[model samples]
Target chain A: MSEDEIEAAAGASVDPDARHAEKMRKKKAVRDKILATKTVEKGLIIVHTGKGKGKSTAAFGMVFRSLGYGLPVAVIQFVKGAWETGERFALERFGDLVSINAMGEGFTWETQDRQRDIAAARRAFETAKDLIRAGEHHLVLLDELNIVLRYDYLPLQEVLNFLTTEKPPHVHVVITGRNAPDGLIEIADLVTEMEMIKHPFRSGVKAQKGIEF
Target chain B: MSEDEIEAAAGASVDPDARHAEKMRKKKAVRDKILATKTVEKGLIIVHTGKGKGKSTAAFGMVFRSLGYGLPVAVIQFVKGAWETGERFALERFGDLVSINAMGEGFTWETQDRQRDIAAARRAFETAKDLIRAGEHHLVLLDELNIVLRYDYLPLQEVLNFLTTEKPPHVHVVITGRNAPDGLIEIADLVTEMEMIKHPFRSGVKAQKGIEF
Candidate 1:
């Protein structure tokens, strides 16, 4: 080992790291001062993209957190019909605090009805609009909604309007799908790209109870 | 201003007023890290107590935010049973994300059946247990669920068990009520006691739509 390398590896070059830490601390101090007085505007839009597991799962966690705060929550599932086992049983717990609307179709394959899919997604949106317009709901989850928009099942501009302009203040919105549109990402405050790390299905492990659903 | 006051303002003040901005920045950093790492658990359980209006409403906001994330979210309402018009249509949007088990009996005033109230609240918890146990849900808002536990309708230990053991690594469980049990607060990662600031009903203002829902 050369003397220069040993010195570089030792405390001789610690000044940069120490300076970086000091800068971070100062930055944090300034931020803490700002937060003490300001009321955080409680609204956000999350877009999930890239092929991965737990996109919907991530959003559901937020729903649980939001309700814990006593805020009104709404959810809309766009594609893939059928009353999910989890949603059916879970929504029953918070009767008034929660709102659920499914397209009421099993899926594109079972129903084999693109028209029906469009109709159901629209109806679900219509119901969702009332909550958004009413301005009572604190969070609204649109599950698989991106797929509907991507497929042209719903008008592009209308949904965009709701997300960008029509939704109420402090009313958070989440739109989840595999391939989110560029427009949605442009407007969204937060975008999560769920890169597929490893999926159970690919491993031949079927979606398990309490883990997948 | 005196010289000391000026100096205090800059160097020695408690600076609560300045903290909001700082907190917001820190929170954003924390939020971003959570978003980036996909490890910042998104959900929270806040017990809003101390005779406040909108305890449940606060929880609803987080629920809405969760939905906005396109997440699967569920709500378990312990009391306030009238199948709300808002909920009737709104829940359809959330689909599997918003799970609500309302007391269905409205308030204690209208309900003469002691057995019914207890049974209804118990039913909500039954579903909440599974939802919490499921482990992948991002957010599970137990709206006013503390009422059931406070009144001894649901077993506190079971609820705690889920919070400690069955809780998903990422899921956020929120409970709202008055006089949260010691055990819950003991186990809670974060607790917010909502003190009554001002209430509309007390001041002769009726609950308004969008604001009070």
Candidate 2:
């Protein structure tokens, strides 16, 4: 639409401020009704998975979000290796509240050896289980754990068992990676699948430091 | 698998460290080849939208990520209203490098009137356009502009025009909200649709301060 047309269409609304106020009042009434019905508070099992990017990034954001609430968080990286990451640098400043462990040598393709990859994944899982069992961390982020699970490095049954039985009631756990198993999805309270509609990386653009890492 | 079975499975690979080293060498060769092919650098218009949550949260994470690179950022909230947000509080600590303008009175439901909502959105758009035109911010986050656009509070054509013609060459702009327009998606370099597989709100949980806001 042209600028004039757009302006005219916008102005067609009679007394927008008053209309908006009334609309809000009605909305709040509905929202209050919904809010009133919700009384349960408990930890959440959030899984971020799919072909798209931002799974790990979003999980990292949650870590920061938890930190904002003064909640202690443990991040166990299963496949990213020892690369210098901006998140580690940015979040580590919180000191004792955040613990970051980069466990896997790298991606499965990068590591190549099935045996070595499995070993690394096992060690990472050990750390993840410990973190959950400790009851100290309010949020535990298992970054790229799905990749390990996808490759059968870590058994899905064990992962499910740990989350259901061993995890503290008030601890939120976020498992992130592509190709989340159906079983994991069934158990998760919150699951977000990031659909990649478009990606610059496919167009031959290299990942940037701050944006990608 | 049982713990013993898992251990045995993990230990099946012989000389894993050496195998891993060889595998990484081959992988790096391929990665280096791919990295060498990528030589272009330009601004990106990214969009985060869909029925799921994390749209706004991911945008906030980007703001923090940009700060890690010491990049100046502009965040203009179109529909989040004046509520105190952890991100606004956290990012504002950076002082002049970050500019956060929450222009809307609140959500459309809360504000009620279509006219008032349109006016608020128009004002926000003006600020967004100016921020883009100034070329000072390396990253600009148009949070919840999608919701306003979905409601026809702002002209989509003009928003698309400004992004395509006026945005700086190196500035990265992230537009986030649900129901992103087709035109916006078409032009965006990266578009991630946060598909809601499961939601906690379905289980009768209220939005928490640090996690949701």
Candidate 3:
């Protein structure tokens, strides 16, 4: 039956299966139209940044989702390597499909050494560039790379040059952290800014193990 | 040796293990302090809202993370029930640990009837309240509940009242959608507004199966 006709029929019936079937039939048409229009397929440079939480969490989520598709994914941590995270622990079960390298000394304030921080950032950036150029991994997550860029620990232009020029055409890269550089935003295929409307931390709630980390 | 002494010793070392150990020692102190002061462990009302794309994705990530900790999680999808989603497909392997119920007929635009939309929203909300009150699940994700609240299909005040008063104190609830009501925001323990800086959809890229769904 036509989707419209089925939907009209569904309006009178109380059966959920009939209603759901009709709804799906109609949705399929709209979704098919969208699918037809979107023909371009290329590796995306996705950036997650802003004042709210979930930037890194969302990036990790994407990594988890990509793994479901059997994609080889690498995570290179920039500023959160110092602390053990639940994601690192959870992702360990994936075996060889995921390669996580926690390279950062710590956050800038936590490290409290400009020269040392710069050296760490440079090493992390080099590792990131290698991962991107290797092309073995379909997705490479540069977790907290934005923090290094925001703090000028790594040269913005140099980072931009590598992203724009050296990144493999087929490698999907995700850069996550607050205060993303403008240059990176301009070139990114997708940029999500997590705005902080309310945080439990402000109300004296500490970060929980599975929820925050 | 004290954590301070170990950190001092590691300052001059090139060994990564030494540095990481030292950093962890210092971080442990700070984290311990935060943990010591945070004794309250109640159910959290988390709202992920805004124009960005990761609201539901992040919530799903939380579900994924929660599952890693062996917590029972349920996802009540309000407006996305008609189509199959990657998360729904992937989460199926967890067996009964994850309960994903896509209850809505469809989005308001697709459903195109106020009475039908209201009925659907009411049914979904009842299911959500049942899940929340049952307390079988550690986390209950009310996906796209904000859309129902936004369109006034469900009264905002009653939703707020239920969330605040009727919800089990230990059941963490996550609501995801755009235009979260201010009352909901005020009552939420954590609120993240996903701001869309740039989207590939705007650039004519189709939503890929694994990435968008």
Each prediction's DockQ? Answer: 0.02, 0.39, 0.25
Ranking by TM-score: 2, 3, 1
Give lDDT tens digits, candidate 2, residues A61-180.
Answer: 677777766778898989874234667666755688889888888777775677878899999999989888998988898988888898888889999998999888888899998999
- Residue-wise lDDT of candidate 2 within B1-213, one digit each (tens)? 987678668754346566566666778898889888877677789999998877877776777777756778898999865234556656755678789888987777865667777889999999999998899988899989999999888889989999999998888899989999999999999999999999888889777655565
- iRMSD values, candidates in order: 19.0, 2.9, 5.4
DockQ sort, best first: 2, 3, 1
Tell how far residue B35 is off in model 2, in angstroms: 4.0
lDDT of 3 by residue, A21-108 (tens): 4665677688777868887777889999998878877776777777767678999989865235556655775779898888888766
lDDT of 3 at A56: 78
DockQ of 1: 0.02
Give the range where candidate 1 chain B is weakest over 10 consecutive residues by summed lDDT.
B197-206
lDDT of each: 0.61, 0.81, 0.80
lDDT of 3 by residue, B139-201 (tens): 899999998888778989999999889998888899999999899999999999999989887
Q: Judged by TM-score, which candidate is best?
A: 2
Candidate 3 TM-score over all chains jointly: 0.80
lDDT for each residue of candidate 1 in B1-213, tens digit (9 for 90 to 100)? 998789777764355434433444555676455445332323344454434443454455455555555667777676774224344344555677666665445444345444676788777777888888786566777777676676566678878887887676667776777778888877765455544422323323333333334
The fraction of reference A/B contacts recovered in model 1 reads 0.00
The parts of candidate 2 lying over 4 Å away from their true place are: A1-28, A81-83, B1-34, B81-84
Among all windows of ten consecutive residues in candidate 2 chain A, which has the lowest summed lDDT?
A81-90
